[model samples]
Target chain A: MPDLGISVLFKGKNLPRLLGGLWAALRISLISVVISFPLGILLGALMTLKNPFVKAAMRIYLEFIRIMPQMVLLFLFYFGTTRAFGWDLTGETASVIVFVLWGTAEMSDLVRGCLISFPAHQYETSEALGLGKAQLYRYIIIPQAVRRLIPLSVNLVTRMIKTTSLILMIGVVEILKVAQQIIEANRTASPNAAFGVYLAVFFLYFIACWPISMLAQYLERKWG
Target chain B: MDHVTKRFGNHTVLDDISLTVHRGEVIVVIGPSGCGKSTLLRCINALEKIQGGEIKLGNEKIEYGSKRLPSLRQKIGMVFQNYELFPHLTVLGNIQLAPVKVQKRNLAEVQAEAIGWLDRVGLEGRENSYPRELSGGQKQRVAIVRALCMHPEILLFDEVTAALDPEMVREVLDVMLALAAQGRTMLIVTHEMRFARAAADRILFLDGGKIMEDSDPETFFTHPQTERARRFLSTFQFDNIKKL
Candidate 1:
């Protein structure tokens, strides 16, 4: 009502540009999540192995990922590895790779926690019931662990969506980058374009993440 | 099970124990806490690795890490103190899971057999009920029915009634008594002296990792052979209850 510059979002081609930018961010995170989810589950099952060597190796990998920041990982893949290994990697490709690595580590740890925390009697009961190792995991362990994993996994997806904002630093033309472009281009026409653009971006992120959180809550209430 | 020796680190839980359970024999093992009664049942089921013995079910030796272990386990059903029913599965699912999946039996046939066993244990019409929906006694009966559904050559019950409420104990014990009367071979570990005395064909009184007295229930309960067994049975006697 007080001329808050909300009109910039409805200006020519601006809303569509922001929509395209939101799609870009979503595409990267979705691709990363799709690749990493199964890989994380598999790696998590491996981490629960009783073999000391496998346990130690997975521990080291988990520690390395947790200790290093995701930005450093992105730079390592995008800038450092390209120069050092002489392998050509596009910014989007590099961002996907880095996100996959980080996502896998985080997701696997989540999976491992879900798996190990299962009541020990489940295994013993399955064994006593003559379930083979494979059958036990397939029938008993996974079915139960999945209920706990789903809500936590939804949270992970939301985190990945937000973290895609960091990819703008590496020249990925995602939502934030597109917002900057609009704000710069509209600097003369709309004096308060930055405020409107960023406000729209905030709504965009909220829209992306809110439904997922609601879905998690709904699932928790239903299954819990 | 012969010359079965089980040790955890340097502590020998079952020391140089040899025993045989004939077809349709009901052997009840009772002792003080940590006296290895549960361990004895576990060893026969190959749930525990025995350091020095061979457990033969019929002709096949039940050895640790055997390729045949899974098949061997299928023939031996073990129930625990806690009724470890799979929470995700319904009563019928828990009972039918092993038979249909591991045994690769027809699902319809397995389901019918599971429901039949459920009815025997007074859990009819509970096929769709999850473990949490049932009372403690109902859960234990379901556990027994779950084991019974496997049609094992023998059943090993480790204190199946120990965790139940006073009223709940009878329902589970009644199921076991029914099984025994039907000539099903079983090895039971329990703290319920009355149920032990009622159900045991032969009692193996264990102490300090040894069978201090192995004799008929009448002899073991009323005329215990060893000083340790006499002292053991005395604890169960409520001499003052007669006055009340």
Candidate 2:
């Protein structure tokens, strides 16, 4: 109502730049989800193995990921490796790598939870029915696990999207980074540009994540 | 199974149990709770590994935790106390899954066989019903049909009717009796004394992880040899029913 900086978004090219930045964040997360989902399922299955060594190793790896912060992981893959290993990794590539690693760990834990939720009799029944290991998983375990997994996985996508904001620290120029640039460019013309830009960014993130949350809720209601 | 000893941790669950089941004979194992009756059936099906000794199906020894266990299990179908039909699958799907997917049989042939078994169990129109949709009796019958569809050489039923409602027990027991009449080789563990007398060709009375008596159903039920068996049978109160 009174110079609340709402005029900043209507300015030339600012909205488009914010939308482009949103796309960048979405892009990194989408690629990460695409790559990590299958890998996570495989890792999840391995985590459930009865072998002490494999189980211990997977537990260590999972705990390592869970304990370490995602930002530190980004710096390790992005700056630390690029300098130490002498390999050229773009910010987007590094973001994808970090996101994939984090997503796979979280998603695998989700998958492992779903897998272990089945009663012991399910395994006994499948084995008694003569299902081979592969057939047992394919017919008995996977079908049921996938149903339990989907809603959680869709929620993982939203988390991944939101977490991509962290990539802005490594200069990825994602939505939050763009919002900062917008606020800086009009620092004097619109004295309250920061509030307006951040509000728009908030709406952008909510818009991106809201539908996915709805989808997860819908699946949980329908299948659960 | 010969000199089969199954130990859980430091405690022995089945201690030096030796037994042989002849072809087409229904051997019902009856005992008090925690007497290892169900464990005996589980060991025969190789669901639980024995600490000592071997079990032979015909001439081949059933190996524990081997790659061939699945193949070995195919010939020995075991039903549980609770009907463990996969909740995710329909009745027809549950029946046809192992035969079609594991056996690599034709789907149409397996489905037709499954439907036939379902019909034989008096579950003619419920092929598409999920396990959750069924009553305890109906689920047990479906579980029986699921086992029967595999065409196993023998069946091991571990207290198959124990979890059913009082009214539902007869229907499942009827299915088992029908299977016994058709000369199916079965190892049944149950507390249903009347059913044991009717369906068992031989009764093995177990106590404290050992077979205390092995005789025909009439002899074991009417004139149990051991004091433990006599005590076990007395707990059933079939004699007291007539007195009442």
Candidate 3:
């Protein structure tokens, strides 16, 4: 109502810095997803195994991920590891590592659910057809699981991207971090700049997330 | 199979049962729904373990705990009630998958044989269709031919026609009837009384985890030996056909 202060966002270094921040956010999301997806799939499948000890280990790992907050996990990876292991991790490295761990745990849980929900008849049919463990997964189990896994994992990726906003707290200049810098620099010159900058950041997130949710819906309709 | 017994945890699903099936004999296993009818076929193929007994299919005695079950199961074909075809694969692919993958047979040979089997089941033009695209009757026929392509010593069918629509039932039965005419040794678990009457050399009526009666079609239908068989057969709509 007072003054939107939309022009203040693009006045100088602010807009490009925000774009760079967006790139940083996407990069971390990509690296973490690419690394974590496969590991999560393996760990997830392993979690459903008949071995008691393996199940116990997976339970502990999944519980640790579930109970710990992402920011707390980031701090642990960044500062805690530096103190404990003496491995000085960069802010970006720590963010990537934290996201990878979080993504793996979430993706693994999704895959475990996908794997376990397969009808018992699926296993019976494959076994009855004389398929071995490898053939069972390669032919019967995995193909069926993937139909369900795609939509859910896409949703997870969008969530991981959104959650990457938390990475700014660990000193990575992601979108939210850049937005804070822009608002702080214009605090006196345009008191209304805070609202406009925040609005842009929110739209950026919406642009990124909407397509993913739409894809998830498309897959649900197409595959289900 | 001699003195074959099966148990789940402490509960015995199949109790002290013995069966001797001759080569080229068609045996139909019939019972109430929860009476371990399917488990017997599962046990025969070593898909299930027997608590205490031995099963000898020809010269190779089945080890209850052996890891080489796929090789054993390869020699024995089975079709399920659900028609569990790989939804991603087309009819030809489903039919040819095991022969090419498991047996390591020539792809060309398996493909031709699979096409030939599809032709036999009247699904020739539907070869490229996925399971989801086919009718229940077509899927069941494909499931049958998929097993037949393996060319096992004996084929086991577990309520294969039970899941089909009433209108679709005859098409699948016709396929089984032809298989019986060809004298393939088979163990069938089904509720199709007419099929048992028409195709079975012997009918085994099971109850409470044991064989209540094992008699030829003429004897079993006309005058069931046991009270259990009588009660089971009484539920059938074939009172008019119960004559030698």
Q: Highest TM-score, which number? A: 1
Location of the lowest summed lDDT over 10 successive residues in candidate 1 chain A:
A1-10
Which lDDT tens digits does candidate 2 get at residues A57-175? 88888899889999999889889987899978999999998888888999989988998899999998998888877888888888888888989999999999999999998889999
Alpha-carbon deviation at B43 in model 2, angstroms? 1.9
Where model 3 places Cα greater than 4 Å from the true spot, the runs are A1-3, A76-88, A210-223, B237-244
Cα lDDT for residue B27, candidate 1: 92
lDDT of 2 by residue, B75-109 (tens): 99888989999988999999999888888899999
Q: Go through the candidates in order and give each one's DockQ.
A: 0.73, 0.67, 0.68
- Write out the backbone clash pairs for model 2: none
For candidate 3, lDDT tens digit of each residue in A1-224?
A: 57997877879988788878888998999999999999999999898999999999988988898789999999999989998999999999998888888889999999999888888877877787778989988987777788889999999989998999998878998999999988898889988998889888888889888999999999988887
TM-score of chain A of each: 0.95, 0.94, 0.95
Write model 3 residue lDDT over B98-169, tens digit each, in one string.
Answer: 888899899899888888988988888888988999999999999999999898889999999888899899
The 10-residue segment with the lowest total lDDT in model 3 chain B: B235-244
- Candidate that beats the other on TM-score, 1 or 2, i.e. the better one: 1
Assess the local accuracy of residue A145 in candidate 1 as a C-alpha lDDT between 0 and 100.
92
